[model samples]
Target: MIATNGDLERGAVDDQVVVRGAVGDDLAGILSVGHRTWLATYEPIAGPEYVAMGLAKWWTSDVVTDAIRKGRTLVAVLGDEVVGVATFGPQDDAVVLWKLYVLPGHHGLGIGSRLMDEVVVQARESGHDRITLSYLEGNEQAARFYARHGFTETHRETPGSGLPESVWMARELGEREQS
Candidate 1:
C-alpha cells in the first residue's frame, strides 16, 4: 500500500492506502478488483458476450492465487480496500506483465501507470530486457494506454478465452529514459 497519496482521488487522499506484496489472503480482493475493472473498462470494447464469459472464466480466487503466487504479485490498496493490482514474472525468455488493472472509480488517476512503472523498475533490476502483454484488438482504450507507456504491437493473437482478435504487445525494457 502506498497511502492513497494523490493517485486515487487527488486532494482527498486515503492516508491508509498501501502498495504491498500480496500474500494468499489478498487473492480474493485482487480478483474482485480485476473483475470489476475489466467489466467496467473492457465491456464497451469486448462486448457483453465475450466480456461476460471472460469474467466468469478469469475472475476466480484460484486463478488469482495462481497468478500472484507464481512469481510476484503487487497490490494497491486504499485504506484497507483494494483499488488495483499487477503481477509479473518470466514468460519463457521475456518478462511478462501477467495482469495490470485499476478499479473503475479509480481510473485515470495514474494508479495503473504507477503500478506499471513499479513493475518496469523491478524488471529492469532483475535484468530482464523485454516485456510482453496482450489486449483485445477492439479495445483501443487499452492498446492506446500501453502504447503511450512504451509498448508496441508485435503480433495478433486469439485470446486464451477463445475471444477473437487480440493484439500482442511488447516493450524493450532495456531502453532507459535519461534521468
Candidate 2:
C-alpha cells in the first residue's frame, strides 16, 4: 500500500462549542460522526454506495489530519465529545467550505447554520471576496440550505468516472444577506 501524504502530526483542533483544542484524539469517533453526517446529507442525492465509498477514503485519520493542517477546521463539541466538523480552505482563489457536517441528531438545531455563520465570518474577516462549496445537485435540502444562507448557483461540475457530480455555489462575503 502506498503511504498517505497526510502529515498526521501537523494539526491542532480547537473546541468550538466550549473549550479549545478539540482537533485530534479518538479519530474513530470523529470519522464515525463524519460518516453519519455524510449519510444524512448525501444519501438523498449521491446514494448510499457513493457516500460509503467516499467515507472510506475521506474519513481516514490521515485525511482528516491533512485537512485540519491545511484548512481552517472547526470542531463542534458538547462537553468532551465532538458532534460536528467544518472546514474552509483556499480553492482556486476562493475560500471553499470543504466540510460542514453534524451528526444526525444534531440536525435541525441550527448547528449547521451556526458552523456556516462562523465560516462566513472568518472568511470575510480574512478578506475573502466570496465563499464556494459544492453539493450533489440532486440534494434539494442541501441546496435549500445553501440558498437560505445566501449562496447562489454559480456553476455545475462533473468529476466523471461514475463520481458524483455537483453544483457549485458561491456567496459574496462583502454583501449582506437581504432580509
Candidate 3:
C-alpha cells in the first residue's frame, strides 16, 4: 500500500513517477519492465547466451508472480507505464534485494533512486539491520550506484549459471524518515 510520487524534470519534462507496492494485477507490468530492462542492461555485458540463460532461470512470470504473492515487489510508474521495478525479501535473517531495474529509456530520471529509497524504507520499517544484493561482476554501473547508496562489496562468487562472477554487496540500515 505504500505509494509516493516525484517529479522528474529531465528527459521527459514534468514527468511524475509514482512508486507503489505491487499487487496481483500488476504482474504483467512487472514482468514487462523486468524483461525489457534485463535484456537492455545485461545483454551488452554478458552476451546473448548468458542473458538468455539468466532470464530463463530467473525472469519467468511465475517467479515474479510468486514474489508478488509474497508481498515483496514494487513498481515505479510513469504516467500509465510501469518504468521500474524492485523486489526484496528476507533471506538468512537479512533483507536481500533480489532485483532492481529501470527501463533504459527512463534511466537518469531518478526512477531507480526512488525505487531504492523505498527499499531502504521498507528494510528499516521491518527492523532489518542490513540489506544485501548481488550483481554481475562486470556491471560497473550497478557497482557505482550501490556504492553511492552506502553498499560495500562483501564478497564474490560464481553461480552455477556460469555467466560471470557475482559481486555481493551490503549496506547497514538505520532508522530514518521515508522520503
Candidate 4:
C-alpha cells in the first residue's frame, strides 16, 4: 500500500482502514500493539513467562525500526490509531512473513485480512512464488485465519524453546490481479 498523509488523516471514514508502509516513528506503536496482541492471544496458551521471553527477544524497538527501515513492515491504521501490523522479508530464497498481529479490541474488523492482502501483494511484487509463516500449534484461531487466506500447513517442528510445536504454512503467490 502507498504511504500518504491522506491515509493517516484523522476522522477516517467509519470502518475504512488503510494499510501502509511503517515508518521509524511507528516503532513504539508497533511494539505496543504487538505486545498487547501477544498478551491477549498467546499468554493463555503459552503462559506469561514464555510470552514475556518471546516479546523481549523479538519485539525490541530496534528490531521494529530496522524492519521499517528495510521497508518490510506495514501498519494498519484507522484514523490516527494503529490497529494492526504485518512484517515480512526475504528469508533464504523466499519471502517469510515474520509477524502479523492485530489488537484484541480490533478483532473481527478485517484488519488482519487487509494486512495479509498487503503482504501477498508485496511478496508477489518481490518476485516470490510463495510466502511462508509459522504459528504455534494448537492456535486454532491462527490456523483458521491462515487457512481462510489460502495458506496450508506444510510441516511441523519442535522449537525446543519451551514453546509448543510450531506449524509451518505456505501459500503460493499466483498472478497478481490487474487493477
TM-score of each: 0.81, 0.78, 0.87, 0.87
Q: Write the per-residue lDDT of candidate 1 for residues 68-145, one digit (tens) a residue.
A: 676588887777677889888887768888788888777666667767777888788888888899887776667778
Local distance difference test, each candidate = 0.75, 0.71, 0.82, 0.83
RMSD of each predicted structure:
3.8, 9.5, 4.6, 5.4
Which stretches in model 3 have alpha-carbon errors above 4 Å?
Answer: 1-8, 11-15, 160-162, 175-179
| Residue lDDT tens for model 4, 1-179 | 32343344333322468799998878888999989988987887788997898798889988888899999999997667787999999987679999999877666667788889889889879888888999987788899898888888899998786778989998887734221
All candidates in order of TM-score, best leading: 4, 3, 1, 2
Q: What is the overall TM-score of model 2 with all chains considered together?
A: 0.78
Runs of candidate 4 exceeding 4 Å displacement: 1-15, 175-179
Candidate 4 — which pairs collide?
none
In the predicted model 1, the residue pairs found to clash are 1-18, 1-19, 1-20, 2-18, 2-19, 3-17
Ten residues in sequence with the least summed lDDT for candidate 4: 5-14
Off by over 4 Å in 1: 1-8, 11-17, 158-164, 177-179
lDDT of 1: 0.75
Error of 1 at 72 (Å): 2.5
lDDT of 4: 0.83
Query: Which number leads on lDDT?
Result: 4
